[model samples]
Target chain A: MSAADTILFVAAWLGLALLVAAFLLTVWRVVRGPTLPDRVVALDMLVGIVIGFIALIAIRTGFTLYIDIAIALGLVGFLATVAFARFILASKGRQGAGVYSAGAPLQDTAPAPDATHVAARGARGKSAAKSAKVAARTSGKTSAKKSPKSLPASPAVAELASVPAASPAIAPGKAAEEKPSAKSIGKPANKSASKTVSKSTSKTRSKSAEKTAGKAVTKPGKPAKGE
Target chain B: MDVVFAIFTAILILGGAAFALVAAIGLNRFPDVYSRMHAASKAGTVGSGLLLLAVGVHSGELSVLARALAGFFFFVLTAPVSAHLLAIAALKAGYSMSDKTVTNEME
Candidate 1:
């Protein structure tokens, strides 16, 4: 056997060995990727490598049937790529532009009127009436402090004076300030927000891919290794 | 003559092996997805081309030789195109870049 032939024999064997290793790496990425889009990217690459390998094998074994595999790869791979991209995009609807689509948060259930508030107001009004009558009797001749605590008896009138205090104290201060919208109320607000962000980013990613691939790939004339 | 042909075939195969080895190593060692892709494309297309060339030489008949040649050229034409598509897809899928190679507007 010639030195060259020995080299070729060893090289082809090694080439096949390397391909095995590469395939495993691709598989690792495919399996371990954190997200759907990441796995799709790895799978797309793995398919391309597979097609190239098939083409090489056809040339090595002189089997045109293998070329059929390459052709099939070309057809199927493109479709699969598109499908995965669509899958990524389909998942983005909630993540981006549709963020507001989560709808308005429902208002807090109005607190039920309780006896305590009514009773407290009633007590204060009676005392205030008595104080006011005392004040009128004295006619400001003697020096005594007018107690504001002794307010009047009509419950609505007491509430009228106390509307600002009642309103502020009735509901939580901050929550009312930033009231959740109808849609977000009693709903998974955070989960939907995260989902929408993910989907829109995925869509942006696919759109960018379409742009990069817009060019025709240049195939240089250099001969491949063996022939 | 038989011995000579066999020896030559062996060497050609070995050359194919070396290129494949480099390609595989590149796939593993490259810093980012795009670089790994570059490795895969080069090794896959060109390494396959070499292996086929050796096969054609070993076969010796014009028809078989012609087929090998066609395969080599076909790989040359299509492998990069497919690889490019793959790389672009990876980039779109948010493959992180370790190095900023260039910032062309078309990118």
Candidate 2:
């Protein structure tokens, strides 16, 4: 081979080795990342390393088209990162707390009460109430500080409180009968309350009651009833 | 002239590969995500830019050079923005830096 050809061949091999190493390291980060955002960041870096590899391949093969692939990857990679970020943000908003820590347990991230959880809680009577009580106790200090006006104004909490505390003794059949009408009444209130909460407390807790409400909402399902 | 160009291309390509290897090492060794991102974004961009420049030099075609230049510019522009966004997302997700990291931002 000519001198230039030899140089080009050696450079290509070196570049390939470096790119492969980068790719593997990025993959390790993606696998080992403690948090969702960390994984996202690692994924983003992986895309970048892929782009670099594409550029190297284009140079080695003298295929101009591959450069276009690198350009498209750059654009699409940015969009992917943004989309992942949005997903995490939406989940955070739904969970109502900073439960995104990598080391934290999954149970800690119990999401806020949505319609599904509300329905489920209604279906499971005594167990749900016990869980709610547990949640209420854990979150009691925060709830105690919240003003009654704010407390009742939040439709989800209001609907929850409006449920006759005595209903725990009532059979599920009768409780179901009463819950439908109450949920219907709560539907409009739920929307306005969610909007206000989302607006006011986009980041940190505006009031601890919201966190308590989230816990209470999710609590009713599977808390080892005898415990 | 051809020999000189070939020598220059060899140096650029080799140097770029070395920088990339360093970047990969830094990514693996860095103590925190923020610092790893710092290494990946800055060194990775420069390394890629140099490799593109080498490719442009080796090709000597106006079209290929133009394409390489475009690729370099696009890489430079987007790499930093993505890094910054990732850092912001990490912070928003409540990721604390290593305790050894000396910054008063949290305080």
Candidate 3:
């Protein structure tokens, strides 16, 4: 064998060894990746490594057919990667149904209710009547703070006022607020205001809160019976 | 002439394998999916393309060489396109970036 032939033989063997190493590493990544995307990237690399292996084999075996095979493999790999991308996008919607999409919007409205709850708790430390009044006003104010442009004047504010007042002191306030939407109307005023704000800023959280309040008010006998 | 071609093919094979090894190491060592992609797609493409070129040179036939060149170009072109698609999908799907990532303009 000539010097060049010896060199080519050694180089082909060396290349094959390196490709085997690459294959193992890429497989490790595929198995260990924390996320789906990580595994996809690793799978993509595996395709490239396989192509390298195919080419090295062609050079060693003197079969040009492997070149055609490598090209076909490249085409298939590209298609696979794109399909995986589409799969990832489609899966995103399903993922959103569980936690992130539902919770993300709620984060905005959540703090508003939380603030009122905190204030109510602080006021309750002093007196129930005072805390009831403070909670009602704060909750109303929070819901009203957003979008002053279009207030549809919902009677839900009466319910909202009562909702935040966990104390029995709301009994008097509820009767008073119920008498005329005009009395507690200054603070936040209506459900439409809160609805619009919730829609523009966050929908699910405020909606959930409203649903809970509605349920609580609708079943007033439950609380009375419990007490 | 055959001797020279053999030496050239050898060199190409060795260089390609070295790049492939680098790509593999980088894939294992990178902190995030995006960085790992950078290693895999870029280095891996070059490594694979170079090996394809070696196949063409060793064959010494014009048609086989053309096929090898075509494959090499196809790899070079498609690797990045696929990587970009994967990245955008990953990002849109809400995969978190590495904590060590300094600045993320993609968000």
| Best candidate according to lDDT | 3
Q: How well docked is model 2, in DockQ terms?
A: 0.17
lDDT of 1 at A172: 28
Assign candidate 2 its CAPRI class.
incorrect
> TM-score of model 2, chain A?
0.44
How many residue pairs collide in each prediction? 48, 0, 0
Tell me how far the alpha carbon of residue A1 in candidate 3 is from the true structure, in angstroms, after superposition. Answer: 1.8
TM-scores of chain A across candidates? 0.40, 0.44, 0.43
Residue-by-residue lDDT tens digits, candidate 3, A130-183: 333333333454533442311222233455444324322112322222332222
TM-score of candidate 1 against the unseen true structure: 0.45
True contacts kept of 1: 0.20
Off by over 4 Å in 2: A93-227
Lowest lDDT 10-mer window, candidate 1 chain B?
B89-98
Q: Can you give the lDDT of residue B60 in candidate 1?
A: 68
Q: Report per-candidate DockQ.
A: 0.15, 0.17, 0.33
Residue B50, model 2: lDDT of: 78
* CA RMSD of each candidate after superposition: 25.9, 15.3, 18.5
